[model samples]
Target: MFRVLALALVLSVSFAGVVPNPATDGDRGEYVTLSVPENTSLGAYTLADGETTVRLPDRTVSGLVALAADPALARNLTDARVVRVPGFPRLANGGETLVLRRNGTVVDRLTYENAPESEVFADGGWRPLGATDFQTATASDVAVSAFALPDAPQRVLAALRGAEERVLLAGYTFSSPRVARVLAAAADRGVRVRVLVEGGPVGGVAVNSARVLGDLAAAGVEVRVFDGPRSRYAYHHAKYAVVDDRALVTSENWKPGGVGGHATRGWGVVLRNPAVADHLAAVHAADSTWRDGVAWSTYRANATFQDGAPATAAYRSDFAAWNGTADASVFVTPEDGHQTTLGVLRNASERLLVQQVHIDDARFLNATLDAARRGVRTRVLLGGAWYVREENRALVERLRTTARDEGLPLRARVVDPRSRFDHLHVKGVVTENAALVGSLNWNHESVVENREVMVQLRGGAVADYYARVFRADWRGGVWRLPLCVLAVTVGIVLGAAGVMWRRVSFSGSGRSGVPRRVPRPPSSR
Candidate 1:
């Protein structure tokens, strides 16, 4: 009947390329149109919900059309090609798949309503729009970018130079001279620059954080020290900044080797959401309150070089926020309770991609393993630097072997330290439709003990952008095993040095009480 034909027309036209119009209320199902192929015709389409199938009209007409199942919906899309489908029973809202068939063969399909909320659809695969996609452009309200090594420094500087108002920075360490000078300059120009640094030592590196802080202080930057007990979290491990109204979170310290120079690989995001910026500012304010906080000069006088920083207050946001069409969720460690990161891994139904500088958390490890066991295709990329502990490598190997035994599609690769950079410092995760980015590392301390910040980005350009980054790093920039064995060799060498020092110390020194060998006077003195 005409109703069947009309319904078919609606099916073909409704989803050709519908994009939500952010100018209107987001949840009202309002949408705009994108150009679809002009010559294409609706051959044969079917809408199926559970057990019912409704055959639509097979039409071969093209050109501008107007469509709406309801009058109100029709009015909103008056400018678009409209097809009036009548008597089409309301499709089940939760589970429905639209199948576009050509000559009885399916050409395209969309399965939606898998989550509790409305999903954003884009020409690019379903994912979130990242800062990189909107940094200098106006495509969307949210944007994100991922920079690795040599490229990161320049982008970071660009962010700093672009700031016009206040700059709030919190880090586990700050040792890059170039970055330091930039902060100084920003402060010199009368920008209210406040820096909160972990008042502790960084692992495996000689920390000159005191010197860095002193230089910034001398330049009029308000510098504060965060020690854990005096602060709230066990360690201030987050590396993030809120400049003007834009926010950036990265998995690198300000050390020259990590974020400034191309010596180590890392990932970062520049967010334009005011909600995110305000939340981070609030975190900075709370962490700045610990009575034990000391001036850079005072802390420097009594500092001992070591890894980790003092505990400080953390920034916790109540809920994930959205900007126009993009969805962003901010999570703070020791508070948000790993909801943002773990939720992505747990909810993955089809694919999961994880790239991290390190991974030792058993919960995260088990989640990935379980996801694979459940038939979800899982890929893991780990850091393969010389300094990477052998145990971490063993952990990855165990996962791979176990998955293989269980007949699961699980694979892992470690980035070659010798390739372009010394290590993979970027920590990120991507599911079928969501992506997570920020300073969070895949470890217990980062999740429960230390302060960390991460953003869970739902479907849009941002998620898509990071998914590409993860894929590239996995395919081109990855190396398989044998590097972990090399790490063991490095560990042995360090152990040998320790043994040699011990031998020399105990050989004849006798705790500095060895009797001096009184010279046997040349036989007849």
Candidate 2:
């Protein structure tokens, strides 16, 4: 009679839809994810790894659950239901099969091989959450406007203020008071304003960002944060906004240092293209509607924020918006961004100018070097900020040394800034025929983990505009002869002069006896 009752209870709460998801080998450890039916009972159920079988705990579980080798290995999945069965077989890193059974009968099974790192497998494939494929929007005579930071802050403000129907802003960080106010005002005026920002930024959330988000929430703006245990991307680092039918994409955060024109040199563009706007809007929707996305109020309810200083200094706008037309191809990271960037580099035939905070990723650096090897003149300009000085210097030296050894037409140096703007913050690529501008940093993690956006603008006018900016920044990293070379040249000149002095008498004024000041060797200005 007791066995009959137990069977009845098991039948009452079925694990009918429960199936093994693809196994994962990520930062935490190797584990198998399962799609368990909501409120499903684990009674009479067991998981098998062909060699060993262990009964699952007799409990009710719903949603995705991780059956881990070590339950503690899935600690970062705060929202997942984790289970561990004693005597369970270890999943092989190379490949493995998992079977789920109920009442000693097979219910579901999955087979996979060589699980990828830091990626979850689902729907018969392995991919990062919120990742998208490369797509291009081509329209002849499309109105595109180019602008630079600390120069045209008004362009951003004007776009937000002009919005009548909808506004969707996505960024890694948002703490700019002026931009926040504009968003609030737009919401107040009946614009359907929405914001999506990274909840777990590199250094944690800032107090000012929290404050700004809170203010926007209070103003009735729909605010969401990409956070929680099941976050799709490692970081929601894309910066762009869709205001009605216009799209504004930038390499800067919507902070005082960025759009507020206070600090950092950045590149931005406003495209009056419906297709572009629609594409970005779709991206925002996908990132914000997922399970990991949390309402601003909900995220802030239990979160503590750190104090941060806001950038306050202002500067005059030097680069005005360049109005032009171009075909734009959009790419998102952890998906097709890296490939698109590589395509741009590989296609360079005449010259390649790269301006970035830093290029730590070997793949990108190698691609740039390959361009130089192909006889394409290449110039790599890295940031000169105090924080990145040492690393940038080392990287610059390595690149220069490689160029010298290989006899490639490549030059690399740290930016001098020259007071044009504070530290280099732009992540831009200018080739002979194309320009890529967006928020993707040239790094492994950025291209493989973070949610980044980049646009390749194809047209002579657009390429020329960005190339112009690149040239200006490149000049800031002034080129000078190496100290050794300069020393050798000076030694040769001085030796020749001494030989001449011994051979011929100079008919000059007595003042000529006084040593003429030798011009100093060129500096890394």
lDDT of each: 0.63, 0.79
User: What lDDT would candidate 1 get against the real structure?
Assistant: 0.63
Cα lDDT tens digits for candidate 1, 200-293: 5445324566667788898999888875332445677888898887777777887776667545566666777777788788777766654435
Q: Residues 73-123, candidate 2, lDDT per residue (tens digit)?
A: 554432357777566567655666778887887777777666554445556
RMSD of each: 18.7, 13.0
Candidate 1 residue spans exceeding 4 A from truth = 1-140, 203-207, 228-231, 304-325, 476-525
List the pairs of residues colliding in candidate 2: 151-317
Q: What is the TM-score of each predicted model, taking all chains together?
A: 0.59, 0.71
